[model samples]
Target: MTRVVELVEHAPAVGVALPDAVGRALAAGDIVDAVPDPYVPGHWSLRAGSKVGAVAVATPGNDEPITVRVTPKVPITRLFFLLGYNLDPKGGWRDGEVDVTGHRDLLPALAHAVERQVDRALRQGLLQGYQRREETSLVVRGRIREADQIRRRFGATLPVEVEYDEFTTDIAENRLLRAAVERLLRLPGVPHDVRRRLLHQRARLVDVAVIVRGHPLPVWQSSRLNSRYQHALHLARVVLENASVEHAPGALRVDGFLFDMNKLFEDFVTVALREACRSFGHSARLQDPHHLDEASAIRMKPDLVLYGPSSAPCAVVDAKYKAEKREGFPDADLYQMLAYCTALGLREGHLVYAKGNAPHAAHRVRHAGIVIHQHALDLDQEPSGLLSEVDRVAAQLVNTPRV
Candidate 1:
């Protein structure tokens, strides 16, 4: 038997056996847990983590796919607006793209919309085609590989292995786009016919290394024409890396499909603050590495490190998912921030968190120069308003001298 499970971000899918075949794949970090259901006594619920993807489970009775689509819990408009500010920054990346508003499943919807944009971009012709180095064996080619010629002289015209760069449509960015699209096609939530069309579209581009997998796309590829390409690249990144896919003999699963809004909120703020600091006549370091121990072996990584005009540490700011009231760990953040302040010899540090009933709070250490400020970002507000809050945070971090 197959099961179709649907869950909200960080929600649980209760009472699903999920078959024996899928057990291993789920353990391989697909971000799910089997726990006793609180609502149902003496029964288990398949719990979900923060990820979103299609889980394919193979059933003995049929060839149908078992899927679990993880949807966002927050308002779609809010999330979309946040993404727009972070992705486009100045309204360039989203120009000419389909509106993501009202999509039932945001992940697949994004993948599909990206596919359309890719198709449209390709129809106009690939932008910035350049020579790529490829290794191959050929009898008559631009260059000959003497090492391969001596080893694999199979008495064939393809014996002369040659490595050379060729100008072709296949590029790293295209490969990444294809890889993401291909992964999305496995999603059961995506319409089957649309999957077929996506497969066809992906086949047009030659496969290449997904080198841009864990890293950002190259800076040189930024241009007016590459706008769509860049957006697809980011979208593909969300599909390929953000969403988790799992499979086994009788089970293929995409169960782990959740996005951590906490992290998203933090990253958006930090990146914006970094840029905003530049405008405020200061330079900022993000995730700056520092040695926390005398041995200089233990490393301490802070979310954002603000530096003064004199190249000294001005302030440090950390982002938290929730406020101190709900999270109940402001003290831990205080300890960490104090270390940052002491290392830089600054008097204060800042912590940003999502808005809660007790959003704004402050703390001061008795008989010490250290102080920590806790501010809340009203995520429920409009994106522009949220950004304005970030601007205020920036001003608070840098207004004092030596900061």
Candidate 2:
């Protein structure tokens, strides 16, 4: 029997495990550690600093292995929405068929979303009818292959290489889609229905398209005739470029497949805060890089910087993922933000963290005459509520002095 352990980001799950199979699997996955309890004797719990949204399968030597999945404490669906927009603003969850409701595993959910997007695109058309230069033998027109005319198939057919506009299922777009679906099919724990859909979609694609493994697909532009595939093409590119496989003796570990929650959080906050500040005559600049030293070798990159309509700095914000224990012991984030403020000649700055204990904190430098306001954006709230928090940050910047 296999056991399933689910954990939230920055949270731990504690349980007792059998020594032989389960214990080894936990060790392999880095999901659990041995804990000695006076009452419970031998116990195991989650690792100290596992990444959020990372799912690992722990395989014991012989028996069925346990699966451990970690989800963000903030509503997982909201994070996906953020990721969808960040990846492509015009393409997002609400407009597409990406349904994550009641999803047990984020990886499989992403795969299903990708499959659905490709499936939807195919419905518009089989993505064929593209003219490609072909080299083959024919009885009639096309450039004849004189070498093949006498050497091979002399009297049967003409060997020719010609460019013809024809309707065939073999094309690069279909091949790339086919490759991505095939890759997803190999992943373990995909939903049964999703697997069936993947299989069905793969069959619809022409089989002869060459599978160029480990090569990035070229980006193709869409015209008025094939404009329907622009969104689907972007989704397919993201999935194919990011998804990969890992194999072992008796197990397959699907690694390097996850949405980076930290980046997602930063992008969401910056975009929202920027939009909010627009009403107040301030535009937010993201990742504003400046030379910190006279030599121009040292550079400081602030996550976000607000500028007035006149093009002057208003406030600087640094988004930190953990902003707490997980960020390590040193107070590095504060030091970095201070550098940003000093470089930009601003007296006030802001630091935003994902909500944790002590939701709001303020710090004032004694001699430097600078202020750092720290606020936590509560992720557990609804999207509207979360944006309202950003609204507060934007409002604070409006009143900030230009000094």
lDDT of 2 by residue, 1-403 (tens): 5455665655655665544444454455444453444465455655423344333344536356445556666565766666666665444444235777667556676777777788778886686655555456454444555665556665655445344456666766677677778777765557789899888888877564757775657556667755655556666665665453243324444242444566777887787777788898788789988877878899888888898877988789888766745347676667777787788888888888887733577788788888888888887776668778889988997776755
**Given candidate 1, what's the lDDT at residue 360?**
80
Q: What pairs collide in candidate 2?
A: none
Error of 2 at 306 (Å): 3.1
RMSD of each: 4.5, 5.3
Q: Pick the candidate with the highest TM-score.
A: 1
Residue-wise C-alpha lDDT for candidate 1, range 1-403, written one tens digit per residue: 3466676765546576454445444545545665554565545467665454445555555665555556665565566566556665666344236665646676655655667766766676665456545366534556676767667776556646776766766666677666667667655566665677687777766444444434664423666757657766665665665555443434343433445676677777788788778878899888999877778887888899888778878888888765443366556767887787776677888888767523587777777767788888877776668778888889888874332
C-alpha lDDT score of every prediction, in listed order:
0.65, 0.66
TM-score of each: 0.80, 0.75
Backbone steric clashes in candidate 2, count: 0
